[model samples]
Structure formats: structure tokens, C-alpha cells
Target: MEFGIFMPNSRNGYIMAEAAPQYDPTHKHLSDIVKAGEDNGFSFALTMSSFRGHGGSTQFWEGSLESMTTMAALAKDTTFMKLIGSVQLLLVHPALAARGAMTLQDISEGRFGLNLVPGGWHPGELESLGVWPGYDYNEYRWEYATEYAQVLTELWRDGVTNFQGKHFQYDDLQLGPLPEGGRVPIVAAGASDDAIKFCAQYADYNFRLAWGGIDALNDIMTKFNAAMEDAKRVVKPYVALGVILADSDREAEEKLQRYVDTADLEAIEYMYTGAVTDTAKGGTSEILASMDQKGAMQMSTDFLVGSPSSIAEQLDEWADLDVAGYMLVLDDYVPDIKRMGAEVFPKMKNFDQTKASVA
Candidate 1:
């Protein structure tokens, strides 16, 4: 199975706790982490786009680097390993996003992908830019995203697009300098039925939060695969994981407790409230439920916290489910990157280092 880092595009990575390693969201830090992943045999890396962050002591995700721009710069530096950047569909036009993705593809020599996010959750953020679309828009956010993806695919593949949809319109426009790969891989989270169908139909990969352990993941994958089969398409399944590792299981547990003890309740409350209030009707309710249970700790449903050997064993359980890959989030980047590269990855099965290189 493939392995990838959910690159820390925001401060404190995804831990959302005061005890988590604090780091600035800077290009240098990102470069270091990506370089470590490159040296370690990670297949790909993806950056999430967050316009604003939860308010609290740690300022969790309050500051973030622009996803596309950062990936564009990283493309010039990395020789192997695909780079996936996120596009908040509501924030940018499809034509603009398509061109930026093509530019990234060229820079990476075809090793580029796009992660599409239907961004209607943060009405405050959208309102700041005067594109909020109002609260009721949530009901049709997925529909808008469907058309958004259609426009992007047309522009990327045809080089010239002329189409009109309920949410977007494009005249006879010619966009040149096609990507090196001719087509860029698309990824989207399969949170709701609409999202699952959309990903099955258009995206090459579907990302989901790996909560509820292996059983939950298996159930989700079963449903997603059925949907893809119905759509007559094959899309790989990818899940996000939050990991905490140490020399021993005891040490790992201690670290996890520290994070839990120092959990930013204020931020967690803000996130949960916003999720319930701002999210649209068709979005994944499971995610909100999980967040409620976990209190916004950013731990995946199947969180991994153990020694290298135990972590490896747990990963084996996941691999047994036939998952395509994982997008990993960590409490700390610098040390954890090295640990994952040096310890856990070597013990995991099917992740042959020799074949991990993207190029």
C-alpha cells in the first residue's frame, strides 16, 4: 500500500492540543518535512487548505500557507513523489484552479494532483471575501462542487471549454500549455453520498477520515466500492490517520494523554459548533459525530499510538482491508518524520521502499 504525509500546512499540525509541538507555518519548515518524506520513501504528500483557524490558546490552524502556491514551489524542489494541493471550490473559479494545477503538473513533470474541497463551511471566511453565497447555499454546495469538478475536468482535458451550469459558466475559452501528464489526478473526500458519488465518478481517489477502527473503515470501503461499481468506475480509497509513536507503547500512551490533558477545549468547542452550524445538509454526519466524541483532537477514527512494532502491527490490520493508502497526520513533524521513515515504514508490509518512489 502507498503512504503519504498530510503535510503540516498549519501551525501545530493536526494535534489541536497545547502540548503538541509548536511550529510556524513557514515554507522552510514545510520544505524540511517534505524533504524528509522524500528521503523516507513516501509516495505522495498533500496539503489541506484552511482559510481561517479555530480560535484558542494554540490558535490551531489559525495560520496556514496557501496550498496551491506552496505545492507549486515544492514541485520545483522535489524530483520524485507526487504533490497534491487543495482548491476550495467556492473561493476560486474552476478556470483559475485548472490553470494553477496545470502549472504545478508542468513543474512536477506530471507528478501533481488536485484535492477539491467544497468550501461553504466557513461562512465568515467566505463573507470576508464577499463570496459567502448565504447560509442556504449549504443545501446545494455539493451540487455546485459537482459542476465545479465538471468544469475543471473539461478545461484540463480539452484545453478549450464552453459550458454552462447552474453554478458556473464558461464561454469558448482556450487554455493552453496542457499539463505534462495530459490529465491531472483528482482527489475528493467521500464524506456524504453526494461526495462519494462525485468521487467515484470524477476523482481518481476518495479520501475519508479513518475513524471507527478497521471495522468502520471496512464498512465505509464496502459502501464506497459499491457506489463506484454502480457508477461503473474504479476509484482508490484513501484515509486520514493521526499517529503518535514512541519507543514503547507505554511512552506513546503517555504522550497521547499529555495531548488529551492539554486539549484546547475552547478550540474544540468552536470547531464542533461551527461544524454543526456551518456544514451543509448532505455532508458526512459521521465526521461531526466523531469530532464530538474526540473533542477535535484531530485523531482519526482509528488513531495509531504505540511503539514502532505495535504501530506496524496496527497498520498491517489496515492494509489487510485493502486500502489504497493513508494520509498521516502527526503531533510533531521533524522527529516524527524521521521516526516514521526509519522505524514504522520499514516494518510495514507491502510498502516496498524500492517501489515507493513516485517518479
Candidate 2:
């Protein structure tokens, strides 16, 4: 399987605990992480787009770099490895998004992709910018996203677009120079059935939270594959996993306990309450409601924490489910990255370093 680092564009990375690595979301730090991934054998690096922060003592995700601009700078700095940046469809017009994507594609020499998010969960983020579609727009956000994707794809492939829809309109619009490959890959997360269908139809890959274990993951993949078959197309499946490694299993367990002990309960509560209240109709709200305190603190994903050998064994077990790859969420950016590259990567059964080098 392939591997990629979930670049920490936000403060405190993915972990919400105060004990986690506290660092500024600076360009130099991000660049260092990207370079480490390239030097290692990673296939890509993805950054999430966040317009606002979840408030608490830790100030989780309070400060973040804009995804597209950050990826553009990384594209100029790196020679290989795809750079995936996120965009919230509600915030930017599709035409402007397409033009920015085209520029990024050129900058990366066709090594750029997009992670599209249909905004609704964090309404305040868009509302502050005067772009939120209001309360009634929650249930139909995906429908709007479909139109948004259609406009973007048309502009990229046909170089001109003339269309009108309930959500967006374009009249004889043209964009160029077109992306080098004639198309840029799209990635998206699908928590509900309709969202899964949308990904099968439009996205090159489907990203899901690694909340459930192997059996749960298998069920998700089965549904995703069925959706693809129904659509007469195939889309790869990826999972987001947090990693915390140590010299031994005991040490790793201790560290995990510390993360939980100092957990940002207020921050976690805010996130959970917000999801259930603002996104009551969405599938993710159900998932959030089902999570326990620890699960919520870990962002409802499996934390692959153990010695190198144990982590490798867990990864091998996960790969057996035929996952396309993993987007690793690290606790500490630089040190953990170097250790993963030097230790854990060599033990992975599905990763071929030679093939990655040639690719």
C-alpha cells in the first residue's frame, strides 16, 4: 500500500492535548515535514483547510496555514511526491478555485491534487466570511458540491464552460492553460451513503476516518466498492490513522495514557456538541455521538502506538483489507517522521521502496 503524511497545517497537529508537540504552523516547519516525506518513501502529503479554530485551553487548530497557498510553495520546493490541498466549496467560487488549481498544477508540474470539502459542519467558519448558505442549506450541501465539482471539471477538461444549475452558474467561461495531465485527481471524505456515492462518481480516492477496527473498515470498503460498481467506475480507499511510536509497547502505552490524562476535555466536548447540534442530519453526527472520551480525544481514529515491530505488524494487518494507502497523523512532526522513515517503513510488507523511488 501507499503511505502519506497528513501535514500538520494546524497548531498542535492532530492531537488536541496540551502535552502534544506545541509548535507554530510556520512555512519552514511545513517544508521540513514535506522534505522528510520525500526523502522517506511517501507518495503524497495532504493538508486540511480550516478557516476557524476549535477553542479550548489548548487552542486546538486555532492557527492554520491556508492549504492551497502552502501546497504551492511546497510544489516549488520539492521535485516529486504529489501535493494535495483542500478547498471548501462554499467559501470560494468554482471558477476562481479552478484557476488557482490550474496554477498549482503548473507549479507542481502536474503533481498537485485537490481535497474537496462541502462546507456545513463548521458553519461559523463560513458565516464569518459571509458565505455560509444558512441553516436550510445543511441537508443539500452535497448537492451543491456536485454542481461545484461539475463546473471545476468542465473548466479543466473542456477549457470552457456554459452551464446553469440550482447552486452555481457559468456562461461561456474559459480557463487555461489547462492542467498538464488534462485532469487533476480529486479526493474527498464520505461519511454518509449519498456522500459515498458522490465520491464514487467524482473523486479519484475516498478518505474515511479510521474509527472502527478492521471489520468496520472492511464493511466501509464493501460499501464504497459497491458504490463504484453502481457508478461503473473505481475509486481507491484511504484511511486516516494517528501514530505514536516508542522504544517498547509499555513506553507507548504510557505516552498514550499521558495524552489522554491531559486531554482537552472542553475542546473535545465543544467538537462533539457542535457536530450533534449543527450537523444533526449528517452521518458524522452519529459517529461523533457514539464516541467515548478517549475516542473523541484521538479524533475517533485508531492510534497505531507501539514499538516499531508492533506498529509494522498492525499496518500489515490493515493492508490485508486492500486499502489503497494511509494518511498518517503524527504526534510530533520532525522526530516522528524521521523515526517512521528509518524504522517502521522498512518493515511494511506492501511498500516497495525501490518502486517508490522509480515512481
Best by the lDDT measure: 2
- Kindly list the per-residue Cα lDDT of model 2 for residues 85-186, writing each as its tens digit: 999988878888899889998888888888898866666678777887687776787888888889989999999999799987778999988887677888
Off by over 4 Å in 2: 278-282
Q: How much does candidate 2 score in TM-score?
A: 0.96
- Report clash pairs, candidate 1: 211-301
The regions of model 1 sitting more than 4 angstroms off are: 278-286, 289-295, 299-301
lDDT of 1 by residue, 104-130 (tens): 888888888899988654556667668
lDDT of 1 at 59: 86
Q: After superposition, how far is residue 41 of candidate 1 from its true place, in Å?
A: 2.2
- Backbone clashes (count) for model 1: 1
